[model samples]
Target: MNISKEIVENVSGIDIVEYIIENDNGIAIGIINFGATITKIITPDRYGNLENMVVGFDNKSKYLKNFLHFGSVIGRVAGRVYKGKLTIDDVAYNLDLNLNDTHIHGGENGFHSRVWDTEEIYEEDKVGVKLRYISLDGEEGFPGTVETKVVYSLNNENELEFEVEATTDKTTVVNITNHSYFNLSGNFKENILNHYLKINADRFLPIYKNGDISGKINTVENTVFDFRKGKLIGEDIDKKLEQLTFADGYDHPLLFDDKIGKIELWESNSGRHMEITTNNEAVIFYSGNCFMKKTPFSKKDKNRRIALCLETQNLPIGENEVFKENSILRKNEVYKRTTKYKFSVI
Candidate 1:
């Protein structure tokens, strides 16, 4: 295992450093301190051809306009908060309404837009980077001063792990997850429609047309949202179901079934397979429904369905009393979660 770092760019007088970690197997991942974002994940296909497996920008300037959230750390909260209203112990806090009167992914200046302090990790069996970010009290209209640490490690077993730990000085709600768009075909050779996915979820939360959670938990049985048996992503994506039409694709949250094991994704053409294991309760499977054709990506011809994201985290605390209560991080208590992605050839 090896880890290397180089100064990539300077943003507003702050130096942005990119760290590259690789294993003996030649699987590597590049991470930039800016947003602690993942720039590339180079892995081999069936025939030993390597290519980037994620959607990112080659030019540093394009990262500044990463509205897609690409491969960055999403913070404070992973999904939308109902109407931007949050309450903690009888104290009402109004968060920034950045997404059509809804507070989505922290806020306009969420963790995804900030530069984090990083430290390289060199271990006997693995190589990684530890990134830390301090969210000031009321920075994005939330409560408490939060100190978050995220460690990303790559091991010889072709496992990329994310371990997150956070603490707050006051009672506040916290949920963090990485928004990495994965295209197992490597260099965007084809859309993810043909990819077969199996999520260990039996229920899903429905969303409105505007992408807000409807606060109702429905079973996935006999519905288009069902992925229990593993099916091609595009098989029923274009169906005229209300949930499919709401977000134009799969952008809703699926509650994880503890009895089941892990989330699996397979790209047959490349023989690349990925298994996702997370301690979180839910995952948001986004089908890149909102990707605009006009926007330039690292590769050309990138449009909707070019990639997909499986964001593992707690259910969005959108006016859900149970979710809000469980997401609270009080003083002296540590919030920790782990998510792992293991890659291999079929």
Candidate 2:
């Protein structure tokens, strides 16, 4: 494996560097210092031709206004905090209600919007990029001065892995996850509805219109949320399900039974398959319902389901006590999570 870095551009007086890490197997991963985002992932399709699989912007200026959180890390909290509030240790923390009264993926100045210190690393068999960021105490209403490092690596076996480590000086809440929009068909404008997915989860955490996950564990035995048997993304997407309708499309986090994610996904059009494994408790499934493509930043009029986010993280649900405990990071305690996505052509 080999790694190379180049200054892509400067945004808001901050230098955005792009790192290209390629494995001997011809799989390459591109990451940027801005937001520590994965800008491109080139993998082979069914025809044995390399294609970029992740959705991304073409310039750095678009990242400055990346409200969609494309290929960036969501921090402090992955899901919505009901009414932009959380009571930790009987002390209240008020957050930015970036989305109405509910806070989603941190706030306007979340990790996804900040520039991170980055460096390249190479081991015997792998090459990767490590991005480090520090969140001040009371940053975004969080109660800790947290230091975090996120490493993204690609190996020879077509495996893209992420390892996140963090520590806080004060007791605070923390839940972090990546927000990458993926379209296995290798086209950002193409709908992923035809892709087949199998998630090793029997239940889902439904969210309200405000993006807050209801603590109630709803069984997916017969609902559109069921993916245990492997179904096309479009099979139940429009089945008149309230859960699907509430968010305008698929936008809820499904509680995993055991590990983080035992997800098997594939796009038939390209015959590309990907297996996702993680250590978190749940994975949020979000279809690009808000990518109205009307934004001046978008060159294409990308609409509903143009891309998808399989965000693996610990959800914050008011009704679940265990979930509440999972979000709290005590002083000097370390928070660590790892997720892997392996790709191949079927």
Candidate 3:
């Protein structure tokens, strides 16, 4: 693997740089220091033509203008919190509610909005960039002075891997995930409804209009959320399901089993396929339901299902059992998680 770096923008005495890591197999991945985000990912199609596989802006100028998290790493808490309330260690912490009065993706000044310190790394077969961030104890109403490190590495096997590690001084909530919207058709000129997808899980968490997880774990046996056997993303997206109506489409969490993940996706037009494997127990599959023409998030049209997200994380945000158990990162406890996206051409 080869590594190169360039400064894309200078903001407030900070330089937002992009690092390009290329492997021998023609797979190249681009990451930016601002937000520790993935800016570009290039892979070859079946016809042997290379094209970018993720959506992102051209430079830091466009990045600063667009608030939508294209390929950035979401953190502190990746999903919504119930009513933005948390009573950890008998002290109530009121967080900034970005959407619908619920604390979503860390809060107003989340990890996605900061420029992290970066270190370039080199090895025999792989090169990577390590990004670090220090979140103050009460920056976003969280209790811990947290230190985080995320490494994005591209290797010869066409695998783009994300390894995250963090430690907090005082006990705090932490759930980190990459917010990369994928349209495996090589580009976003068209919607991703025709793409085929299959997830191994048979149960999913339902959601409310406010984006909070509602109700218990429901079976996807007879629902549109079912992707156990692999099916076109559009097959049941328009069905008259209650959850579908609430979110305008699919915005829920599907259980994950590493034994046979089934997190496989392929574009019929481009013959580009991707498989995701992760250590997180649940994943949020969010269809781009809020996209609009006025929304500067994309150059693509304001389509309902243009891009879909597969965010692997600990648990869905709401009042849940897992929330009581996994969300809190205690002091001296090192938190670690890994998610990998491997690419190929059918």
lDDT of each: 0.89, 0.83, 0.83
Top-lDDT candidate index: 1
- Per-model TM-score versus the true fold: 0.97, 0.95, 0.95
Q: Which residue pairs clash in candidate 1?
A: none
In model 1, which range of ten residues has the least summed lDDT? 293-302
Candidate 1 segments whose C-alpha is farther than 4 A from its true place: 259-261, 298-301, 320-322
**Please, what are the lDDT tens digits per residue for candidate 3 over residues 38-100?**
988888889988988787887566766446677888889898888888888988888888877
Candidate 2 lDDT, 159-259, residue by residue in tens: 99999999999888889998888889975436888889899988888776666766777898878888888999888788776777888879877878786
- lDDT by residue (1-346, candidate 1, tens digit) is 9998888788889998989999999999999998889999999999999999998887766777687788999989988898888879898899999988899998888999999999999998899999999999998898999999999999999999999999999999999999999999989889999999999898999887788876789999999989999999999999888888889989999998893347999999999999999899889999988687544454445587899999999888765443687689999999999999999999
Query: lDDT, candidate 3, residue 204?
Result: 91
User: Model 2, stretches more than 4 Å misplaced?
Assistant: 294-301, 319-322
Highest TM-score, which number? 1
Q: How far out, in Å, is residue 6 in model 1?
A: 1.5
